[model samples]
Target: MSVLELARAEIRALVPYSSARMEAAGGATLLNANESAWMPFGDAGLGCHRYPDPQPAALVERLAALYGVRPAQLLVGRGSDEAIDLLVRAFCRAGEDAILVQPPTFGMYAVCAHVQNAAVVEVPLAADFTLDAGAVLAAVTPAVKLVFVCAPNNPTGAGVSLEAIDDLARRLAGRALLVVDEAYGEFADGASAATLLDRYEHLAVLRTLSKAWALAGARIGCLLADSEVVTLLRRILPPYPLPRPCVAAALEALSPAGQVAVRDRVEVVRAERARMVVGLGALPGVRAVLPSQANFLAVRFDDAGAAYRRLFQAGIVVRDVRRYPGLQDALRITVGAPEENDRVLAVLGDGA
Candidate 1:
């Protein structure tokens, strides 16, 4: 049997939790699975009495429209976190299979692989924080099931080149899935990997409502992939993966009114990001300001621990990315509201 067939047979024989939604059928009387007798609290504006559509068709349609892809190409999950977990679970086999990651990138890629008992192969980005194509190509083996590239990457905040990603996809065409985690793609200057989805069947682009859309609390993320992949993932995902309230919130967040608000917020964040980069670059003990395509800037400090502590004490909660590979003594500061940015700048200026 082929490798994929062997993998599928192994997975198919493993019993997954039989969710109520999975067992229930579309019938007039729906009396199979026990649901709450009383009505749910609060006017969610959408009916919460009924279980949310297993995949939330309306949301998928709207997202497909927004991302310029077909509905069949999308899978909406709880968040990018869940998407990362699902991809690892669906593709990587325990102990035998592996996945490739670019370090100083998203932690969840490695985290999910670990949870699935999959080996993680690290391909450290170049000193300039661009894709080390040679390193990536060298790391992939037959055991590797997936390769995760975080564009406009987390912490480091640099977008990987489209040419590099395409090349990587081409190399792994039949061997592994190339997942481009575009969680921050909306903030980047170029068109997203969604535009290239048609060209590469092996390419999957992960998008989220958390960053640019300002809907972190809503907990909605989209995975754009080939329909066959989406179908397999859907079979494994939790039925009612999205709660009714979250689905409503996400739908509202993607509305025309919400889109305008998000655009305004994006502009504000982008402007703040630019301003903060310049201001932070001039601070005492500041080593270098990494160019950012995301809403946050990764700043190298002479004393990151001290700076992190000082910022924390001042009621600012920027992320300390010193633990990440190649990012020792670096702090990731998210661009906050105008006044908050000003406060952070003021605190940094004091040289504490």
Candidate 2:
């Protein structure tokens, strides 16, 4: 049987959630979806009444141009979070299929697996937050449908070696999909895994506008893979997933001017990250500040709980990554504005 045929029958037969937007037909008429035909005036001038395009064409075209890939290979979603969920549902069979994830990384991979009732197989990263190819290969099984590796990984901020990723993709060929989450790829020094899409049919890359493009509020994310894979995953995405305003905003955000702005912001963030690492490293309780290729720093403190409390009391929020394997006493701090970073440093220095 084909892989789709072998997929969960429930998913095969599953009818997805349909919205007013989904049922709308193409025409000049304005009756369907219960939206106001006219635009609201004054401050609310932008007409948000019309349902957005199901697959935003302009955004796709612009993203395709930016990533140097065909538009057919891209699927934009609410965030990488939605893409993760959709992939798991479309490929994995509940109780029978599984996904492989590397730890000291993002939690959503395991969460998505659980949501789909698929088991999660973990291959924790080495002490330096790098992949262990042998450990990963050993963990693979026939039931494993996806292998998720976050590059410039969360909590650790280190990029996975390109060779390791290529090797994993080669090893998993014909057995499972290799998903590389490159949410922070923009901050890295080299090209992204998106560049390798042409060579690997089962390889997928997840990117977000939240980190680099500074569009977290727009809720934009991109999934780039082989067109066939994108087709399969698209069947499960919400119809009219991109709102009209969001589409407009994202289109604007992907323009030449937008690209320049994003690049400038990334440079600022990278500089701020360096400043944070240096400043935080000098703190009395800090143990180590790991090298990072992304816009955040993973700081190891003498007592994570105390540092967490101190930061919280100072009105600064940082992620406590103590739960991650090999990340005990570590806190993941985002690179904020200079003033914000200084505030955090001041609080940490004051022993608060």
Candidate 3:
């Protein structure tokens, strides 16, 4: 079954908005979209006065190359949040269709589904934080339109194996779209799920510069899917999803110099993560440091409330994930710079 068939009928039949920019391009024109003739202050050679391209072509090509996908298969959005929201809105009909997600993972998947008034089916991961393929496959009903699986999952800091993801995709074939949020793919040890895109037509991968690339404030993310799916999402996306400065920022982040800089940073984070796991594990009140393939470590403390206070007192803030299922005494800590990580270790040793 093609994914397009699973999409809402209204969306399949709807006509997209045609803005002035979409109508025409590439001419020495004035008075077309009606804007100021002067460039804004602090333009920085990116021409901030003019509205950004509805779809920045060059940036699209750069990202496609970086991810090993064709340009036509990519859809750029504000962030993974927007892509998640769009997938829910485009496929799941209110009060009818549903999406599946695993608990102790990213919350945005459920939040987006709830905002769209679609049912969210929770399939909690196994006790070890690994995917229970059989349970997930058994939960796929005809009403389920999308399934979200986060790799190197948030809060827990555990990764789902590619083989498991591949098996699940085959099982859900023609039934639902399998979305792999690879937000921390760069920090992982192996290849990305994007390598499986050509094999599974219903597969989609979400990527962002917020984590490894270190551009959280820019808020740029991408959806890598089949060309048909890309075309459908393009229609529903806002006419101008990226602004001039954001486009420039993303381009620079993907450049040769930027790539080198980010790689260096990734090395630092990875090294610090190892040091943290050992350091925090030996702490008095710490129980266990869950294995992590991402930039952060999820630590289970004997008394997380007290640990949180110690870190807070030292002007260090980390995520308290006690509310997440199976993580009552866990706190997620990002692997920061050497000095910062040392500070956190020092504070935790203060016996607060």
Identify the candidate with maximal TM-score: 3
Candidate 3 lDDT, tens digit per residue, 19-48?
Answer: 667876778865677778988788778877
Against the true structure, candidate 3 reaches a TM-score of 0.98
What does the lDDT read for residue 287 in candidate 2? Answer: 96
RMSD of each candidate? Answer: 2.3, 2.6, 1.0
Assess each prediction's global lDDT (C-alpha) against the native: 0.84, 0.85, 0.90
TM-score rank, highest first?
Answer: 3, 1, 2
lDDT of 1 by residue, 4-88 (tens): 3423455545566666667657786666667664566885456666677788778999999999999999999988888888888
How many Å off is the CA of 53 in candidate 2?
0.6
Q: How does each model score on TM-score?
A: 0.93, 0.92, 0.98
In candidate 1, stretches whose alpha carbon ends up further than 4 angstroms from where it belongs are: 1-7, 12-29, 43-45
- Worst 10 contiguous positions by lDDT, candidate 2: 1-10
Off by over 4 Å in 2: 1-26, 30-34, 40-45
Tens digit of lDDT per residue, candidate 2, span 1-352?
A: 2335424566666676676656646777868677777765652644676777677778898888888889998999898999999889988988899999888789999999998899999898987888887899899998888899999888799888788788888887877888999999999877778888888888899999888988899899989998877867776887778877777788888888999999899899989988888899888989999999888898998988998998898789998889888988899988898999999899999993
TM for candidate 1 is: 0.93
Query: What number of clashing residue pairs does each candidate have, in the order they appear?
Result: 1, 0, 0
lDDT winner, 2 or 3: 3
